[model samples]
Target: MKTAAILNKNQLSKDDITHLLMLQDEHEIELLYKKADEVRKKYCGDEVHLRGIIEFSNYCEQDCLYCGLRKSNNKLKRYRMSVDEILSSAKAIHDTGIRTIVLQSGEDIYFGSEEIRDIIKSIKTKFNTAVTLSLGERSFEDYKMWKDAGADRYLLKHETANVKLYSMYHQAQSLRDRIGHLLYLKKLGYQIGSGNLIGLPFQTIEDIAEDLLLCRELDVDMASISPFIPSPYTPYKHHQSPALTDTLKTIASARIVLKDAHIPATAALSALDEKGRERGLRVGANVVMPNFTPAPYKAYYEIYPNKYLTTEDPVKRTLRITAMIESLGRRISASQGDSLKQKVLA
Candidate 1:
């Protein structure tokens, strides 16, 4: 099939996306990425927004098969930051003039409602910056307490929108429960963020299309999509990872489908392709999450294989990504307001 013909098929159905994924032609994928990049540039412009991420805890209760820190993995070292420690980290991030701090962790049982609330309160009071929580699923009361404590956004990736495939990865977790939590978060007036992995052991392109459709249906404020990277400790270690070209195509298609959601040029995307981050920005991704975790704990913050481990040095990763954005004719803003919302809406 001609590249132009494939690109012109604007309303990509499940079958179409599936067909594109199956095609192993490198030339076709590159052509699709270039076209998608052009479209992304037209809509989003040549600028990247940076979000500083702090992986607060690695202690998780869930046993997700693909995650390195799953509860079943007893070999993994687990750690949780005290409220004071968290506040100190937030203060350092604030000094960098990065207004957004993403407080992410695996679903840990150690921090109950009160502890989580205290952490959120401390960050909000001390730094006076936007707080985003990605601490796995929580109850309505817990979410409300955090929101009331001044959390502005929440990210909970659905992992995969396909129910059966979701079951394959998450044996103990329920798809209904995950979806309900996201919907509940939305109802609680939190800026909801949900997404899926691009390629998994059994994921089809139709599954990816369904994920995009679900994001639109939910009216999500942020959509984080990353290509599946196999972990050595995980069950699917030997499975082939998604091709870099396929990953970029998914990002481009996502930009076209969910034009108003904050799409991140994920570290996984960048890890897969040499210029994946730059290409993603050109193809509709507007947010880049630079790590802000302290150096001593950097190696322990692995969610997937070969993840970009950021140092305690606040501006190291941020500055590098900023320069890359500049090289691509884009600028990274020091001000951390919700520029994502503004750009998506514009």
Candidate 2:
């Protein structure tokens, strides 16, 4: 493929990215994945960063069409962990020697800015870990407060780049507003993670390309390219799950486009296929997020069904992921897995 020929030049236009995203031939796709894996090794090295995710709250206010936690899901049960409970979970993650703890939830307002800042402060104070927040969009003050509290990173996946599709799914706000929050978070000195969703009903390859372009434009430090796993309680419940091939292609493309960014082998892939995460690592992804949300709440925090893997003991889970990473000929890093681009700039 001529696309692969130019990938080495680091001069991809939207059309070039689109061409790579649209690679339908199995051989061509495999070649693309190979090049992406090479880029991942060359830029990020062989250390797989294990980020433990604590889904502290299932409560969300957004009514997006695809989410099981959307405000529209009346049948879903939601809960928020108290400060002590969250601290306990963070300690569990810390004990596993994981350097990053991602505090993720729906946009649950129950925990105000002070509550979140306290959580961030406690995690940093108690452990040698960096904090990443995925609590949806908040005010500039809220973002800045969390940053001041020692939050090291933030991940807000810009689900789609097409304005029309973004408006369709995100009825409450515009794509422009979402982008504004991400940019503001960047200004606050957070290692930004902005990503796109693949396999929407009417989404085209061009839309995916635009997503890659937006990530590059924002200079995101981390990115996630996961398939749209249709959820039962949402409007997209009847929609078909995206093919694993397409999602893998998108992941590889992100690795090539955002060469130094930390891309995860998303769980949605593993849920769709047993070997998804392994396949993701084979292609280009360099991070894996093990669910550390205590088991009682794990079953209920159903974003998409059959979540990748969770266990009663987070230590055991981390050990399992550790073996998996080492088996892949990659070592799980003890470092915080900070962005390579930022270090280069510094």
Candidate 3:
């Protein structure tokens, strides 16, 4: 199939998506990126939404093969920030003009749902900002509690849509169950986000195509297309990361397929290349999530090795990120960065 025709299509079939992902010709790939950029411009404007992430805890129960923070990794130094510390970091994020506060941690139920709910309430009351929870998968009751406590969004990356691979990587975690949690979160009125990792071992172009299709089917408010960077102390430590071009193509394709969804130039991209985030913005990504996890803890929240900005001061990093966004002819968003989709609860 011709690249032009594929790019011009209003609706993409699974086969069409597969073919686009398989495009190796330089000119055709460029066309795919151009179409994605055009679609991004039409659906999402030139404002790069910033979400300040605070990885408060590095403790995780499940031992996923790719993550460095897995429970089995004895070498990792785990720490959980106190509520006062978490609120302090959130204040730092707000002072820098970031409106979304993303409280991300591994699946550490030690904080209990009520503890998390209190933190959510404190942040909501202390600062007029959006609170996004990424504390792994939790119960539906816990989700309702957090929502009632003023949590505005939830990010639970489906990681991959292929059933066999999902089980293989997540230690038998069910993809159906993950999807169920995402659906239930949306049902509770929180703007939901989910995504897949590019270039996992044994993953094929067909699998990636299915991942993009899943994002569209879910009608996610945000979709993150990030590279699979191998971590230092994991089972797939030596596996090669995906090519930069492949990652870029996936992001561009995602924008074309899910036009109005907020796509982020993820921090993992920067670990792949210094200009990875900027490159992602040019293609189709409209959101940038900068980590504000305090130093001692930030360095330990290494889901992957050589995490971008793990050591930089949050204030300095925010300034640099602001300058970088401006360099791309984009401005930082002032709103709490609400969902682009029209509200229709399931």
TM-score of 3: 0.97
lDDT of 2 by residue, 26-77 (tens): 8888889999999899888899999999999999989989889998898888
What would the per-residue lDDT of candidate 1 be over residues 212-257, giving only the tens digit for each residue? 8888788788889898887777787787778776776777677666
lDDT of 2: 0.89
lDDT of 2 at 225: 91
Clashing pairs in 3: none
Off by over 4 Å in 1: 1-11, 19-31, 307-312, 334-346
> Using Cα atoms with residue i matched to residue i, what is each candidate's TM-score against the true structure?
0.90, 0.97, 0.97
Q: Which stretches of candidate 3 lie over 4 Å from their true place?
A: 307-310, 342-346
Per-residue lDDT tens digits of candidate 3, residues 1-346? 5789989999988888888888899999989988998888788777789999999999999899988999999999989999989999999999998999999999999999899999999999989899999998999999999999999999999999999999999985889999999999999999999999999999999999999999999999999899999988899999999998899999998998998899999989999999999999988999999889997888888888764455779889989999999988889999988987753222
